[model samples]
Target: MNAGYVRLSRDDDKRNYTSIENQKLIITQFAAENNLIIDRWYEDDGISGYKFDRPGFHQLMADLDKDIDQVLVKDFSRLGRHNARVLLLLDEFQERGKRLIVIDDHYDSMQTEDDTIGIKTWYNEKYVKDTSQKIKRAIGARQKAGTLMIRPPFGYTRSHKDKSEIEIVPEEANYIKTIYSLYLQGSGYRMIAGYLTGNQIPTPSMARHAQDFAKGVISKHKIAIQWSDSMVRDILGNDFYTGTLRLQKRARSTVHGKDKRVPKSKQYVFENHHPAIVDKASFDLVQELKKKRIKSNYRSSHAQPAQPELSSPFGSCLFCKDCGSRLTPIRRPASGRERKYYICTTYNTKGRLHCSKAHLIEEETLMNDLIAYMKLCRNSLCKDITAYNLECTGDEKKTSVRKQTELQSRIDVLKKQMQILFTQKIRDLANAHGCEKVINESYDAMQKEILTQICESEKQLKTLRNSILTDTDKKERSQSALQITDRIIEMKTLDRRDIEILVKKITVDKDGLPEIELRYGLSHLIPCSPSCHLNRQENEIIYQCMNLILQSDRDYTSARYLSRALTDIHYPKSAKGVLPYIGLMLKAGILSQGSSPQKPYIINKNRFEIKKVMDTFIKNCCLV
Candidate 1:
């Protein structure tokens, strides 16, 4: 059987002479003229010749030893541009007793000596390398002139007048503004994404496709209508929304190599190059908030927490004053009741050798203390806004600046060391030290370690730079904190989002007292306050109802069962009367309803709010 192989890459498509159709025509005509019939056809379209692992090529190779007695191509370049691989493939053909034919080069294996095949393969490889370099130079020239062709970002489209420039798409720009607005209003990436998805807003990809469909450029296809946290994060982090053109941030080292991220110092950033969707100040503020959140949530240990979704409001805010480590939440079962508490992470993981005290504080008690502190601050601010100074201290700024300088200097030193090691490795390879394999392996390991350190140091430096707040930023943050404090006081509950906006850290001392640090430099030691006391009669009623539900053996206790149980206990009430208490318990997160509407309720043992309400009632009141 005779096999005809056809291939055409992007470079080949530039000229009609090397098109797939043209190659097929030439091969078919040559076979007909030679009175030979081609039985199998293998074609790889728009694939690089430098890559030998293409599907069409693999199929052709698989049949070489079985059905294929002859392989034909228009030229050797069509088979491959990889010099070594192509030479080895030619040898493979000879060893397998297969006849080879290249019409363009006028080569037939059965009739030719093929002494110049090696040189021809090398020239083919050189052509590809030269073409790659030429294309890169052209792109470089365009980039320097701000005329490089690029796909526009989500909220933009290429200008009709000048394809090199971008203009805002009004509908898409509105979504971009909404994302930034929600982020500044203390919405997390996931929360913002959920909001957009719930609102049925089209994602960037969907919107782009819709435009193309409307223009009749492509047929309509099904696309997912969803938004992801990563999409939200990308939009929020893009300085392009602020009318900046950031380009050349990624490039390939070799023609066939994967693209690598270019360092910030090497990227081209042109400010005010297009219409703005978000202001520079707001963008900077969002970046600062993102950095703070990342720093707070980062844990030294790689292990994930057991219940991340059920994490306390103070998860990121709580810390230990003694060891200066973030506190971790733990749940303990006590007499059939589960209670949540926060302890110093250092003491919990390590022993007394690292930290002397647990600094244990109940979740309920911490919430009460934090609420009281917020109330006190709100009262103080209401009386006189200037009562407490919120200006950042000079010493803190100086220390941060010093640290930034040190990190930058360290990064510079690491880069120099990396260059030196690379030079040393080259010299060793050239000199053929002790064993070639051992020398290469040792240098490769060292190179990997140094590269890892350099990446880590660069990341730390970027985070530090983002964390540094300017004077304008401090003033704005202080005013925003005041507003957030008022809102939290009015709600009388602190959620995770509220904590992220208002508090920087809550440091608990060895005595288990928390010091509240506000975001804009306000710090206070929360004064001890009386525990919340509920009405005795109401507490008794709640206790009786909760006890009945807990004592029930069934997984789900219906409201009717609770009414009957209460009557048997001499506290008679109809199911309708029991509904009120059930509603309150559900609202407090102490009880959860089943998935189906007909199913009853189940106790929520893991909720921290349950412990607060239950313990307070159990201490002050007895069963009714």
Candidate 2:
């Protein structure tokens, strides 16, 4: 059956010109002109054409089960403006043997060429870009005219007669004065925020929400009210209190979407553009004092110095074992000298009652300990390497032989399953139509699914049979790890780069005792056959992921924490990317869980399970 989809959004037009009624009328006319029967008319009112995620769209998608033969729309942009999303929807329709017609764009999915569809889709995307550029140019023109294009600063509000002009808010101005007074009186940003929070004074964000609520710009429910240290710092840094408005403090690129601070040379500073809450002299004085305090804080040592060692090689690798928060670098006055040490960030900010431990470990002490740890790791690897060196140049090739035999065994089982399906098909249709009758649709479908499985198993077996490693390949690959071990054994001191090569992360407890995690290269140590289910990188990631889950003391952990832990050890990884690794582990019975994958994983017999997995690597004499 043919269906029509129509949508209109306020962003398209404030007036009812692009209303739902108008779009439906257009679709109706198009269907009538083409002599097509409209089974249903789906309407999405007040929804953006830029996004496909609408209630009406989802309902129409669900109705595909009713055998929708064709979909008609007023235009391609009405279907959706985003090129990639709209194209994907078109592809889905094509795959299901459904036709799509866009009247205004003169595009028909069944009749139009791929490149023609692509060009029309490109035009739809370009419309959004053109609109964005126009708005940006308008803003630029206003900026050149010294017009205030941003929201009112902390102690000010938009003028009653002129919305672009700033006016002093008497009540908020008093708080602004108090903040400057406190800073001049030697109060830090943290203390200032605390004082305001303790007194029940609304923060800048809360105050802005209050103004927005008064003007009916936003609903009362959205007035999220809170005070924080960063807010106080932002208020203190703003020079708007001195009757000067700053513009272009930060710039965001259209291509790369991250905001970066515009250099001082490029930033525009307009003086005396707003009502004064603080004098220019006071603002300048506060800025100078801030500079001095920052310079003092960054110094190496104070008074009598302890024996200086190399600077902290570990940048953000160390963490507090108890809270899992990073160990922030701090210099504390100790026995008439400044000592550089790391403390748990949570305890440093929230106090001991929250974390119950400072986790204070000096950098020099941690550095020396790390050096010793690397040496110990190198020695252990060297012993393993020596044994592997004595082995007969990979003569038996036990791992590849075992893997090939296992894959062949799986293929045998799949072949048997196929044969059984053949027998079942014969019995199922023995006398359905006639003696020469073909298998029914149900049996045919079953056969297809089984055939796919059998093909995959046979392919895996073929790959295993072809991928054979010789004795020389093993010795050559093992050389790099052996060289690294030998180098670490001869080294007297270690730096940050050296530490990165040896360790992944370092965890320290409340008592300053440390636990180091070595980055053992599993892919190189236990090489996979060319036809293996996983590649070298995937195998390494799987091994590391399993170790992280099993080694943790907690029985369960959120997907978020697992992803973050991996990211902190490696690159900036998100929870979604780690799912495949988790799937692989689950497939091999190396990891187990009782809850949903979205929920926390409950590692069952984690120690025993992980040990069994590691035993496989050891049995293969995996060392490279």
Candidate 3:
């Protein structure tokens, strides 16, 4: 039977023309025209098409019981717009003996007339990326022009004359102010969210009341409702609450037209955009307080409850005490129950496999170490700050003057280059002749390099601003010292949430002794890997994944499964980010996957050689 799939990216509000009903209609017409029977229609409404984790899409793929002959979509983009994901899905379909037909794009399942699917796909991918860049530029341009790109937030309303200008919404503004005040006084996020919901205060989205808002031609009325935890968190996280207009907190995907939250480094933060809802001092304090809160409950040592980590937790941490090879996690089936243990990654390999086997650390130990480390880090900031201030930073003025001048100089140069590049890009477009591909590539490469340089310079400037002029001793002595107080309170309890915020890295020495690194509210001290501190059980699992990849089939699904399982063990690190390394592993025959036109995957192997290599790398015996 033929199936249809429809996906509306997160940023692309589907309540408009891209609604399920409308998509069904479009696909139904196309299917009828082609005399194809519609077996099932899969819809991932309001989900980003950048990743293949959408609920409906996964279900469609996993529906092995049902006989699916072909899959149809409005465009290949509906399956996924990301180049990696799109190609994999297409390949997967072919593997499964199921064909895919994208109607709107004229990509037929049976047709190989042009035989340029790969090139066309690349073009489509580039188009998506180019479109995203254009959108960002547009937003940046408006922001530079002093025009507001977002709504006036919950408490404020847009001025009648100027859409960019913000005016307080009188009653709502007062309520919002009260909320801020209450939060500063120690009201938690959930409590505040509950309070607003209980009082029936309209959420920011609800207050918009756009009865005929245009998402596209076909529109629908979506009733906005009360505030939720997520909404409250978003509001609280906004630097604009402190009278700063920080634009570009989120970015649109080039391929999917979906929104993903950008790292703080990429944001275009302009101070004093609008009237402050809360003072800068108070806003900063709130941010600090939020950091002290930690979530402790975890099913595995590698799991992080709420936030993404900057570095891998498990990288360069696990090692075998006996052989000095990294201990890899091993799974054993005993009495119908699965138990995890650690073995030398090279234990069962050729050439004197070393180390007497050791028993696995229980899951409980994993939880204990993670929670304890988290608590220690969250609680140490104030003390560390105190210690750091006393020991270092005798020459503040010298650093400040030097940094400020350098930043200003760099900014001036970048602005001049940016202007030239803008003009050059226009010229390139207008004069598209003589190896257009080569010309475009050259221009794009230059643009990318320029943007990267500008971004780095901007980051250095931000760092300088945060430090330099501020007197650590005087600041600490004068106002209710935010650092010392937070540290004392958080460390005492060692709460799970507190630990999550404070602990940066946990490294395990050769003797199974774990070392925890604290962030100390400073960027410089952050460790690259924390999971190194995890016991042997965790490392074993990572080793297993490496072995599975080396021995099994090479495919996205296989790698994803390995990633998921390893995550459950203690490699809470993401495999997706290390795609190049993974690809390398596949090429080296250290990792392998089963061949399937659709859903290629890595299989579990009962060997320790793969784990040994990974262990050596983690222990720094082998460089990454």
Best TM-score among the predictions, by candidate number: 1
- How many clashes in each candidate? 0, 0, 38
Runs in model 1 lying further than 4 Å from the true structure:
13-16, 160-165, 177-188, 219-222, 280-315, 320-504, 510-513, 516-624
> Judged by lDDT, which candidate is best?
1
Clashes of 3: 38
lDDT of 2 by residue, 375-413 (tens): 555555665666554563464466557756765776687
User: Where does model 2 exceed 4 Å of error?
Assistant: 1-4, 9-16, 28-69, 82-92, 113-119, 161-164, 205-221, 250-252, 255-261, 284-624
Cα lDDT for residue 436, candidate 1:
85
Tens digits of lDDT, candidate 1, 1-624: 999999988865355357778788899999999999989899999888998979999988898878999989999889999999988987788788899899987777777576888899898899889999988876775454344376787899987786655788999999998888666554677777877887889998898897787777784556668999899999999898986677788999987889999998888655445667786767876787788668766432123222224445665668899888888878778659777788998899997789999998777657766776777766655533333323334455676688678768877987898899999988888989568899889998777766665665565556556644456545655564457577777776787656765677778887566777766644433332222221333355577777665565655667888788877876555575577678877886667888875667877754354456777767756432
Over 1-624, each residue of candidate 3 has an lDDT whose tens digit, in order, gives 788888876444233437667777888998898888898878888776666778998888887337777888877667775777677767677667777888777786566465666765676567556656776676675554335656577767777796645666667666666566545543555667766777778777666664124323334336658667777777777777765666667765544446889897876665545556665555665576566433211112222222122111332233444555544555557558765434445454533435444322332344456554444344444565556655444454565677678767877897789789879877877787776788778778767666655665665566456633226435644433345445545554443333334444443343344545555545344343344434343445445556555555443445566666656765553444234345556664554565674655443333476566666756853223
Tell me the lDDT of candidate 2. Answer: 0.67
- Residue 134 error for model 3, in Å? 2.0
Question: Which stretches of candidate 3 lie above 4 Å from their native place?
Answer: 1-65, 68-94, 98-114, 144-146, 180-239, 252-266, 281-624
Q: For candidate 1, which ten residues in a row score worst on lDDT?
A: 299-308
* Ranking according to TM-score, highest score first: 1, 2, 3
